[model samples]
Structures are given as C-alpha cells and as structure tokens.
Target: MRIAKEIRDDRTVLSIQEDRIDAHNSGELKNLVLKTLEGGAQNLVIDLARVQFIDSSGLGALLSGYKNANLRSSGFALAGLQPRVRSMFELTRLHRVFDIYPSLQLALSA
Candidate 1:
C-alpha cells in the first residue's frame, strides 16, 4: 500500500503513495489507519493525492477508518481525490458519508 504517516499541528496525516487501493492492499490500508487511531490521533487526514484508482475494498477500508475515528470522537477526512476516484464515491453515495476536500490544505483546515 506504500502508506506514509506524519503528525503536524496535532493532526495525523496519512498519505497513500500508491496509485491504487484495491483488494490486494485495502486490508493493509485499513490496518494502518486503525493503528494510527489506536496511537491516539484524534484528528486524521488521509491524503489520497497519489491514488488514481480504487475499488469496493478501498471504500470499505475508508469507511472502516471513519467509523473507528468517530467511535473515539475523532475527526476523519479525505483529501486530493481525483475526478475518477471522486466519481466512485458519488456513485456509491459514500460522498455523503465522508468529508472530502479538493486539496490537502483544505482538508487540514477543515
């Protein structure tokens, strides 16, 4: 999955370095996000700027992360979604479930 993590301004920023998040890597992604949450990152911003493709498993992983964060009364937001990836969320109506931003700066500010 090639995930990277950084903490800035009291928030955790998890960035996916891979081009795709699919069944093959979704589990890894989910586990990492959960671990980050367990590490006490209440404000999380997942940067998908490098991700150009995603599938159902990817969506599930994101939702799972969101649920986990919410359980802790934390924040979870997605940033830098490409148009195609954005469309998938819209098609699945996940756009309503997630707080998405067009840029990392916007996500962080939000």
Candidate 2:
C-alpha cells in the first residue's frame, strides 16, 4: 500500500503515493479509506496528485468511499487529479460525483 493517511485540522487527508491503483490492492485501499472515516475524521480529502493510474477497482474504491461518507453524513472531496485520471472520471461521469479541488486547502475549505 503506497497510501498514507493523516488527520490535520479536523480533516482527513489520504495521500496516494502510487502511480497506479488496481484490482490487486483496491480492497486494501478501500479499507484504508474506511479506517480513516471510522477513526473520526469527518472531512475527507483524497490527494491524488501522485496517482497517475487507476483501474476500475480503484474507481470502485473511490465510489465506495464516497458512499460511506454520504451514509455517515460526512464530506468527501478529491484533490490534485492528474489529467489522465481526471479524464477517466469524466468518461465515467464520476467527475460529477466528487467535489474536486485544485489543492488540499481548497478541498478542505469546501
């Protein structure tokens, strides 16, 4: 798992330090996100600046995380999407679901 999670200023930041997230580890990725949520950080921001690649399973992880956040009445946001990954979200119409931001600060503000 190349992901690192931290809580700062009452917000959760999950940093994906990997170039790719795929079927082999998406489940673990999802678990990490859930763990962050369960750990009491309600405002979530996923920093995707380093995630140059993502498969369907990775996308599933994001969607599931969003669902979990919604169910818990918390906020979920995405930040620093690479153009390629952003394209995938656009193609899948998921760009509409996630509140994307240019930076972590912006996401936290929203």
Highest lDDT among the candidates is held by which one? 1
TM-score of 2: 0.93
Residue 82 lDDT (model 2): 90
Candidate 2 residues lying further than 4 Å off, grouped into runs, are none
TM-scores, all candidates, are 0.97, 0.93
TM-score of 1: 0.97
Q: In candidate 1, residue 69 scores what lDDT?
A: 95
lDDT of each: 0.94, 0.89
Q: Which ten residues in a row have the lowest lDDT in candidate 1?
A: 1-10
